[model samples]
Target: MTDARVMRDRQASVASAARRLDDASGQHSGAALVQTKAVGAYPAAASAYYACTPLRIDGPETEGAAVTFTGDPSRIIMALNLGSRIPPVGTRLIIHSSGGRWAFRYDG
Candidate 1:
């Protein structure tokens, strides 16, 4: 039989893991895939923000490769579904994770 202290620790660890799973797999989700909008023809660049409505995608990203980033510019552009007004190539994307603890811009 495990010691009382070990049992308590195991319980705590399991509880912690459950909480994280719920948080990451919640209704709002943790990491979001964003699509930037076209600012205009001026400056030749657009902002990395301007979130859109979730397409009610319920499967994994791989299940929806037509929406996720697949390293192919055309695929991402079509996946964004922002309309033909968007630039032919992809736009700048600055992802902020961990409550703003990490942020980096992706121009490719």
Candidate 2:
């Protein structure tokens, strides 16, 4: 009986952990910096930004970088390293979305 109980508890714990991971991952989405076009939205539009060559925008400092947030999935946010000259469309930009916030990174 004790062994059964231990096994049940372990299973429960594993299930709980898996649930938590799934819930967390569901809150975020990823996309790439395809094209930074000048939309009519002014500041709300995304631009071909530059960062640290191999730029990464994931923190508060990213506020100043050239980019914009539309909403969620599809066109959530678009950005690039502050120093990198606008990469061509289809540039793979690893993106993370959490609580309606975004972070950008160039895996290249």
Candidate 3:
């Protein structure tokens, strides 16, 4: 019957559309996996601990004195030079002057 044939053709079209959609979904997943792998391959930076008491210094306007944190003096230091107008010794600062750095200290 013509109705049966029409129904079969419609079913075939629906199945084809489903297959294409499935293929697109698979490609999207593959692309996402590749991106994740690429990001994971890069090395992450090490974190430095901030000192409770920060040192205050005096110097020129251009450069600020380096205030080293308590735990790791060598590793962590306020890159701001001595004269740079920075927050007080004990104030916590997200050091934007240099690289994206962070520190906390009010007085010392």
Candidate 4:
């Protein structure tokens, strides 16, 4: 499936995941797709993030090849999803943690 479609699906799945997380933790932690609007013009960054967190997406990004990075993020996860390229399984990612509302974006 296309990255956009994957992101759209993630948006839908996040709702249910959030509910499940809340049910398990008893805390409200919302999920969203980090979009180009928040990141930049390229979808690579968004896609990279999508591979990481479980954020809801609301826009489109540059199309071509792409890469995804997914794992536990005690911080921010960054990636460059472009073209049809995909990150290898078990790739490490970088994250930046700030005291703010927690959000996630995943495209898998």
Highest-TM-score candidate: 1
What overall lDDT, based on C-alpha atoms, would model 3 receive against the true structure? 0.31
Best by lDDT, which number?
2
What is the per-residue lDDT of model 3 for residues 12-92, given as tens digits with 9 covering 90 to 100?
A: 987765453321124312111000011122212213232222223335446555543332122223232222233333443
Model 3 stretches astray by more than 4 angstroms:
23-108
| Model 2 per-residue lDDT tens digits across residues 1-108 | 699999999899877654433211254234332333333332321333422111223434554676543322333243434332444443444444333334454333
Quote the lDDT for 18 in model 1.
51
Displacement of the residue 99 alpha carbon in candidate 3, Å: 48
In model 2, what lDDT does residue 102 have?
40
* Global lDDT of each candidate: 0.36, 0.39, 0.31, 0.37
Q: In model 4, which range of ten residues has the least summed lDDT? A: 93-102
Q: TM-score for every candidate vs. truth?
A: 0.26, 0.26, 0.22, 0.21
Q: In model 4, which regions exceed 4 Å deviation? A: 24-108
Query: lDDT per residue, candidate 4, 2-107, as tens digits?
Result: 9999999989887765443431113443332332223333243333433343332224466754544332233333434432443343333222222322323234
Error of 1 at 31 (Å): 9.3
For candidate 2, the lDDT comes to: 0.39
Point out where model 1 deviates above 4 Å: 23-55, 58-108
